[model samples]
Target: MTSFFLIDDDVAARCMLATIIEDSDLGRVVGEAEDGYEMEETVIRYAPDMLIIDYLMPKQDGIETIRRLSGLGYAGM
Candidate 1:
């Protein structure tokens, strides 16, 4: 199965996404981060194939996060 990562700051939203990821057959959640600050490290450790990120967050938004991830050699969008 495909590996997945979630990047969002909302606790309830994260929980809901986790449930969806677990219940769906498309992929599994291998990692999660509450904000952009944790994304780089967490993603590197989990090495997920896909990332479902929120549009807004503290420290850095999804656009910046995507940029950073791209800089780190992540090709997903």
Candidate 2:
């Protein structure tokens, strides 16, 4: 099964997305986080096949987070 990791400051949004993904049989959520700061370790640990990140966040935006992850060699889609 495809694995997914979710990143968003909004708890409700995360929950809704997870539900949709699971209910639709799209994938499984391996992990989740509210912000991007210091999340590389967890993301690396989970090593999910995909990452669903919010474009806007309180601490770090999605683009920056993705860039940072990419720099650290996180190749998730």
Candidate 3:
């Protein structure tokens, strides 16, 4: 199963997506964060194979989050 990381501002959205992904056999939820700033360490620690991120979030938007993740050498799809 594909390991997945979720990044979203809403706790409910993250939970919902995790459930849907797992329930549909799309992937496995490895970790989650509420925003970009809170995700750096978790991303590195979990090293998920896929990332499903929100387009809009506080502290840092998806674009910035992508950049940060890229800078950290993450190649998750």
Return the top candidate by lDDT. 2
Model 2 off-target regions past 4 Å? none
Q: Assess each prediction's global lDDT (C-alpha) against the native.
A: 0.83, 0.94, 0.89
Model 1 Cα lDDT, one tens digit per residue, 1-77: 88888899998998898898789877888877889874586686777888989989989999898888888888654
User: What's the CA error at residue 68 for candidate 3, in Å?
Assistant: 1.0
**Candidates ranked, most accurate by TM-score first:** 2, 3, 1
Which predicted model would earn the best TM-score?
2
- Global local distance difference test of model 1: 0.83
lDDT of 3 by residue, 4-52 (tens): 9999999999989999999999989998888887577789889899988
In model 1, pairs of residues that clash are: none
* Two-way TM-score contest, 2 vs 3, winner: 2
Model 2: per-residue Cα lDDT over 1-77, one tens digit each? 99999999999999999999999999899999999988988998899999999999888899999999999889989
C-alpha positional error of residue 54 in candidate 3 after TM-score superposition, expressed in Å: 0.8
Residue 11 accuracy (lDDT) in model 1: 82
Local error of candidate 2 at residue 40 (angstroms): 1.0
- How much is 56 displaced in model 2, in angstroms? 0.9
